[model samples]
Target: MEFLDLQLVHALKTDGRAPLRRIASVLGVSDQMVARRYARLRETAGLRVVGRLNPRPVGQTVWALRLQCVPSAALGLARALARREDTRWVKLAAGGTEVVCHLAVRGERERDALLMGRIPASRAVTSVTAHRLLRLFKGGPTGWDGIASVLTPEQRDALAPAYPPPDARAQPVRLTDLDHLLLTALARDGRTTHAALAAEARCHESTVRRRIAHLRGAGALFFVLDIDERSLGGPSATALWLSVRPARLAAAGAELARHPEVAYAAATTGRTNLLATVLCRDDEQLYDYLAERIGALPGVDTVETAPIVRTLKRTGSVARDHDPADGAPRR
Candidate 1:
């Protein structure tokens, strides 16, 4: 990616809905230049800004599933899972023998139907492990650390989103039918014009605009950028599962989230309580990270590294009419 492309991404990460004019002002470039760069990035680099539902704020449960499938069934099963709206980050790991994804469900009944009834009954799945996400130290709405540091502090501050206070966040915001439709359209393209959203939602443009602002302010909605990491020049991507002392789990996870290599970090329930994905420039850098950085972390007992072979899905939920090349929901 060009230096300017990287900066634009960082700005979007800060606030995905920021106007191109505002982004250009922060980057000290012409608004047309920013627009051209964004369009080119989307066309060539597979860049997508998607509005995603924040499950936590809505009383939903999040679980990570690692399914060891028969080698022949791996790709098929990964694609099937990716097609589900409940699954995200679907990947083929452990040399294409494992399908891993994050599952979000509304309640125990919904969770049980998938985790207990459906998944366990699959004949092709050799083994399966489910980990409940207890806390997220990074990723999700926090964004990844890879392109996070590209923008200057002043630039970031200029684009950072204004979130509601804790008191407001504590109350779950009920979503309307229109809200769901609006979000569905935005999921396909976060920068979709307000008029387009209104047409999709079958409502007035002003109403669509107000509802979007309300959802964002209520913490029910947030934006995520899904991009081709290859453009960022990373040669290695590995998933790390760590067993850390309970007393130090939070601290360890927090510290790990700060590392530039970590794309996602969270605390989960299972034998390995912490999970993280790290991207390195090369194998040598990966070794240095494992040997020095991880080795220096406190209270981390054991580390399990699984090299990511391929990603079937990344940041967006797969809509019914999904585009094959990218994970975009059909408009």
Candidate 2:
């Protein structure tokens, strides 16, 4: 990817709904050029700008699950998990036998049933470790600041969403069967227009517009930007397991979230309360981050780092050897 590619991603990470013309104006490029670059990136990189729901604020729960399976079954199982709407993030880890993913459920009962019933019964799964996510330090569109240097503050402000205060988050929404249809469409493409959604949901266009706005304002939906890290010239991603003192967990988490290297970080229930994904240019830079940054943080008792070998699935896009000429991930 070029400098312009990174700028376009940064702008979209701020606002997935921002018009192409607006993005072009902010970047000092023609709308057609911006559109062409986006098309190329999506075509070559398996990029996805998706509308995702933030479950936490809506009385929902998220659990980080690591499934250890036979190496032969790992990719297929990961694909199955990725296809499920309830399973948000799924990745085949560096240790080829393990598949790491998040299960976002609406209620405690649903979360319990999934862990105790369906997963354990799977013949391919040898072991299951579920960690309840207690708090989110990052891991959403708003937290991806890795491209911060590419956009000016003024440009960024123009695309950012209005983040209401913690106390102001909307309550869990009551869903009609039809609401699920609207959400399914949004999940695939957040930028899917209202008229299209109405046609799909078999509802009036005004109803589509009202429902979408309500969901957005109700904290039931949010936008996330996903792009190929290989194309960005920085492909290495690491998952860090951190043990922190109970008293200082919040402080340590907040501090860790401030670092641009962190793509996803959260407090979970397990021996390691903190799990984070760190993005770096290479091994040397990763060493620096783990040492000078994470190691320097107060109350961090211990840390274990695992480099992600390849991402099998991101938010909504699965990794394939898209650039078939070389038979490799797009880069």
Candidate 3:
């Protein structure tokens, strides 16, 4: 990616649905130039702006599942998991023997049926563990600093959307059939026009716009960038499980969230409460990140690193069920 391309990406990270003219103004470029770069990125970098639902506010419990599968079954198992609507971040790690993913379920019965029943009965999986996310310090709507810092403060302010603080007294919003249809279209392309969404949802364009605003205002929807990791730094990333003292866990997670390399960080119910995804250019950079940055964090006891072999899914449903050849974009 070129410098201008990165800036455009950063601008989109700030506001995925911002018009090309707005991004152009922020980047100090012509609208045509921004449009050209964006089209080129979509063609080459697998750039996708996804409007994802926030499961937390919708009575869903999110769990990080790690399945130690037979070496031959890792990719197949990962692809299968990625096809499921309830899964996200489906990845192969631990030298291609472990399949890791995030799963969301509405209740204990749904959670147990998969976690305790079907998954445990699979012969290809040697073992599995589930970590319920207790609190999310970062990830989801939070843009990673690595790709988010290219724009100047003024540029960012120009692109940033104004969101009101959450209301504790507000009632939880339920997902309607129209909401599902609109989200399905937006997940494929977050910048999908209101007319397109209205066509699919069988509603007026104004209704589509108002419903989208309502969902976002209720803290039920936000946008995320689904760009190729190789465009940022490298083809792979490492997942870290840090055992931090409970007294300083919040501080440590917040610190990790600020690191440019960290794409996601959260506190979980597990032996190692702090989990983060760090991106580095190479093995040496990964080593330095573990040794210098993570090692210096206060109250961090032990850190476990699992270099991802491949990530099959990030934010949306898998576009294809088959694995890609090496060096190809996984999107």
Candidate 4:
């Protein structure tokens, strides 16, 4: 993907449902050109602009799972976890012998089936570390704001959602089967039109629009824009585990969110209360970020970094493990 495509991703991150013509106007390009680039990206980059439910207000939880196992079982386990609907991200780290996954915990029954029943029974798994996310200072669309500078202030404002504070309380919603159908369609393709969404959900277009607005208002749904990593400097990724005092976690998370280098960060359970992913050009730059920036933060007890050797899956999109610019999966 080119810089223009990256800017397009930034625009979409702000408003995934924005019309191509509107985005083109902001990017100062012909509407046709913008559409062509998006088509190419969808085909070549394997990008998915998907919808995700907000779990916090719904009595749900998010946890980061770290598994250290023999090298032989690493990829197999990572792929297996990625295939499950509960997992949001699965990464092969520690030079391919370790696996890190994000679990969106919905209820105790679901959690037990995953953490106790299914995981412990797997063979060759040496260890498991579960980090329950207590709070998320920045996630989803909020975490991608650093790239918004590509657009002018007016363009940015135009793309903002009419929905109130992104932090609005989310009451749990028991979606009907029809509601799931609509949301699933949006998750597969957020740009689907009202007509298409209505068809998918077997409902009227008016009903589709009304339900979508309700979901948004209840803070039950949000969309995520997954841009190609090659456009994001390089493929080098790291997961940081930080030990911060319980009282200072909120402040620490807020401070961490301001750093442009932070791709995602949240407060978690276990010895470390914070887990963050940083994207950099290379190891040297990553070291500089850790030493000069993270080291400078107050109340940071300890910081451990795990470079992501390969991402098995991210937000339901499969990333190429080698030669990402060519968009080929590693063999």
What TM-score, over all chains together, does every model reach?
0.91, 0.89, 0.93, 0.92
Question: Which pairs, if any, clash in model 2?
Answer: none
Using lDDT as the measure, name the better of candidate 1 and candidate 4.
1
Q: Model 3: residues >4 Å from true position, as ranges?
A: 164-171, 319-331
> Mind giving the per-residue lDDT tens digits that candidate 4 earns over 166-236?
44255567787877888778877888999988877777999998888887777787778866565554547
The model with the greatest TM-score is 3
**Number of clashing residue pairs in every model?**
0, 0, 0, 0
Q: Give the per-residue lDDT of model 3 (tens digit) for 69-155.
A: 999878778888888888978988999999999998999999999999988988889998789998787787674757446888989
Cα RMSD for predicted model 1:
3.6
lDDT string, candidate 1, 305-324, tens digits: 88887776788544233456
lDDT of 2 by residue, 123-182 (tens): 889999888998888877546557535898998888666654222145757776777788
CA-lDDT, candidates in order:
0.82, 0.78, 0.83, 0.79
For model 1, name the residue pairs that clash. Answer: none
Winner of 3 and 4 under lDDT: 3
State candidate 3's TM-score.
0.93
- Ranking of candidates on TM-score, top first: 3, 4, 1, 2
Off by over 4 Å in 4: 145-148, 165-169, 318-331
